[model samples]
Target: MKGLTIQQMAIGDSATFTKTVSESDVYQFAGITGDFNPAHINEEYAKDTVFKTRIAHGMLSAGFISTVLGTRLPGPGTIYLRQELKFLAPVRIGDTITAKAEITGLVLEKNRVTLRTTCTNQEGVLVVDGEALMSPPKA
Candidate 1:
C-alpha cells in the first residue's frame, strides 16, 4: 500500500492485523523491558495466579496496534502523538491476537488522527481497548 499522509485519511477508516503469542516472545519482551514478573515468565508461578499460566504483557498487545499504524496502514514516517489504553484480559502463550484500529476523528489542520483501537484473542475476547492519536506524513 502507498504511504498515507495526514490529508489522505478520514474518520472511519480502519485496519486489522494478527499475531500469535509465543513463549519466546514473552521472554524477549521481558528482557527488553526489564519486566521479568514471574507471572509473565514462570509457568509454575503463573499457575498460582488467577490466569494459571504465563501471560503476555499488556504493552506487548498494545504494541501490535502501534505496529499496524506505523508499518502497514499509515505506514513509515507516521508519528504517534498520544495513546490511551485499557487492559481487559490476559493474553496467554499460543493465543492468536488480532489488533484492529478504526479512525474516529481527524484534524487535518493539525495533522492529527484519532483511532479506536482493540486487540482480541482467537476466542473473540477483548484483551486490550484503547485510542491512539497519530500524525502521518504530509509529504
Candidate 2:
C-alpha cells in the first residue's frame, strides 16, 4: 500500500477504477452526503427535470476519480489537494463507469502531481472530465 512519491512517479503514470452505478449506491451516497437533491433521490421529481430521470450525483462519479489517486496511481498515503471537474453527461443507474487518472505534470520541489482525470461509462461515453493537483506521499 505504499504510494508513489513525487520522485517515484513519472509523467505517464496512470491508473483506473471501475464501478456500476446502482440505485442503492445512489441512495447510500445521498444519505452519506446529505445532498438529498430530488434529481438524485426522487424519481417523480427527477421526471420533471431536464434529465427526465433520476441521475447519480456528479460528485459520486468524481469520488471514483479519488479512488484512482488514493489507491492506484499514487497508491496509499496520497494527499489530495485540489480538483477541477466537468460533468459532461448524465450517469444513470446501472451504468458502469471507469475512472481514470494519468500523470500529466510533476513538481519536484512541491512534491505535487498534476493528473488528467476522466470517467467513461460502459457505452464509452465520457461522463466526467477533470484535472487534479495532489501531493504525493513523502519518501
Candidate 3:
C-alpha cells in the first residue's frame, strides 16, 4: 500500500512498475479483449506493415500505469477518473517497459490527484505519455 492519500501526496511524489513484453502478453491481451487485429497477431500481415513485426497492444502497456496508480502510488482503493494517452512508439515483444507516474497536482478539497504518466522502453525511448486524474480513497 505504498500509494499515498491526497493529504499525504506531494507534488513530486512518483512511482513506477516495469515488465518485459512477451509474446504471451500480446496474445493474452488479444484473447481477453478480443482485439485480434492482424497488426498484433498475424506475423505475415505485420511483416508487410510499417512496424515489420507484431506489436503489443497499446492499452496493455497502459495497464502497467494502472498497476502503479492502484497498487504503488495511491495504493488500493484509488478510483481512476480520466486518462489521456499518446502512443508514441510501438512496443514489440521482449521490450522491457517501465511505466511511471508522478504527482504534479493535488486537489485536497476534492480528494483528487493529477498525475503525469509515461512509459519507456529498454532502449530509453518513450513509448507512451499521458496524464491521469484519480481519486484516492479518503483516509
Candidate 4:
C-alpha cells in the first residue's frame, strides 16, 4: 500500500476511523490478550463497579488510533515510535467510536511526525486522548 512521506504531510492534516464496539469484539480482544478482567467480560460482575456495566477495554479504543495512523494519515509503512494515552470515559458495547489523528508537528530531518489522537463515542463524549510519534514512509 502507498503511504505519505514526511514531506507530503503537513501540520493540521488529519484522518478518522469509526467502528461500533461489539460484544464479539470485546471477547476477541480479551482472548487474544488474555485479559479477562470481569469489567470487560462479566456483565454480572460489572454491576458492582463504578461503570455499573461491562466496559470495553481501554486498549481497544487505543487500537482505533493506530488504525488512523497506519491506514490513513502517515498511511502504510509508518513506523510507530511512541504514544501517550489518557482514558477519559468508558466505551460500552454498541457505542460507535470515531478515532481521529491530526498532524501536530514534523521533524523533516528525522522523517518523524507528531500527532494529536482522540476517540469519541456516538454521543460525542471524548473516550480517549493521546499523542503519537511516528516515522512516515521514506520519500
Candidate 5:
C-alpha cells in the first residue's frame, strides 16, 4: 500500500467493502481486544440477550469502516480523525457485512474529509450507521 497524503480525495468520492463474520473472527477479536462478553461467544448465554443469539461486537462492525477508508477509498496512510457510530442491529456469525462510505465534505484548510458510513448485512439489514472523519494523504 502506498501513502495517501491529504490530496487524493474529493468531496464526492466513495467506497465499499465486505467481510463475513465467523465464529473464529469473533473469538480472535475477543482475544485481541479483551472483549470476551458472553454474548459474543456463548450461544446459550447469548439467547438471553435481546438479539436472541451470539452477536459480533459493535466495534468489530465499525472496524470495517477503517478497512474501507484505509485500503480502498483513500487507500493507505489515511488518518482517522473521528467517528460517530450507532449500533442499529446485531451482526451474527455467517452474516456477510457490506460497509459503504460516501464522501460528504472536504475541509481544505484542515485537510480532512467527512464520510457518511453504513454497514448492512446480506439480508439487507443495517447493522451500523455513522459518520467518519479522515485525512487522506496527498496524491
Candidate 6:
C-alpha cells in the first residue's frame, strides 16, 4: 500500500496519472456510469454540437484525478471529502490526458489536506481543473 500519513505530506507534495482516451474507454465509462450522453457516445449527433465530433465524458477525465489521489500522492487509504471542478476543453479519442494533484493546504487538527487538481491534454490545453479536500491515512 502506498498510503501517506498526514505528517508525510507538505504543501507542495504532488502526484500524477496519465492515459490516452480511447473509443473503448468512452463507451466503457458510459456503460458503467449510465451517462450515455449523445455528445460522448454518438458521433453524428456530436457533429451538430459545438464540439463538432464525439468527446469523452468530462467525468471520465475527472476520474483520472481520483487515480492520482487514491494511488499516488496521499495514496491508498486517503478519504476523498469534496471536489470542485471546471471542464475547460473537450477530450477526444486518442488524446493523452495527464491528471495531477498538488497539495496546497493542510488542516492538521482535522487530518485533512487540500489539493489543487488539474488535467491537461496532449496539446497542453487544460481540460479540467479543481480543488479537492481529503483525509490522509493515519500514521
Best by lDDT: 4
User: If the candidates were sorted by their lDDT against the true structure, best first, what order would they fall in?
Assistant: 4, 6, 2, 3, 1, 5
Candidate 5: where is the Cα deviation over 4 Å? 3-7
Candidate 4 residue-wise lDDT, 1-139, digit = tens: 8789998999999999999999999999999999999999999999999999999999999999999999999999999999999999999999999999999999999899999999999999999999999999996
Which pairs clash in model 5? 4-137, 5-136, 5-137, 5-138, 6-136, 6-137, 6-138, 7-138
Superior by TM-score: candidate 1 or candidate 6: 6
Q: Mind giving the per-residue lDDT tens digits that candidate 1 earns over 1-139?
A: 4469877777888899899999899999999999999999998999999998889999999999998888866778888888899999999999999999888988888888889999999999999999998888887
What's every prediction's RMSD, in angstroms?
1.3, 0.9, 1.0, 0.5, 1.5, 0.7
Clashing pairs in 6: none
Best by TM-score: 4
Two-way TM-score contest, 3 vs 6, winner = 6
Per-residue alpha-carbon lDDT of model 6 for 1-139, expressed as tens digits? 7599888989998999999999999999999999999999999999999989999999999999999999998899999999999999999999999999999998999999999999999999999999999998998
Q: Write the per-residue lDDT of candidate 3 for residues 38-136, one digit (tens) a residue.
A: 999999999999999999999999999999999988889899999999999999999999999999999999999999999999999999999999999
**Model-by-model lDDT, in order?**
0.90, 0.95, 0.94, 0.97, 0.88, 0.95
Any runs in candidate 1 off by more than 4 Å, and if so which? none
* lDDT over C-alpha atoms for residue 34 of model 3: 98
TM-score of each: 0.95, 0.96, 0.97, 0.99, 0.93, 0.98
Tens digit per residue, CA lDDT, model 5, 1-139: 6745556666677889999999999999999999999999999999998989999999999999889988887778788889999999989999999999888988888888889999999999998999999887766
Regions of candidate 2 where Cα sits further than 4 Å from its true position: none
lDDT of 1 at 18: 96
Off by over 4 Å in 3: none
lDDT of 2 by residue, 23-94 (tens): 999999999999999999899999999989999999999999999999998879998999999999999999
lDDT of 4 at 83: 97
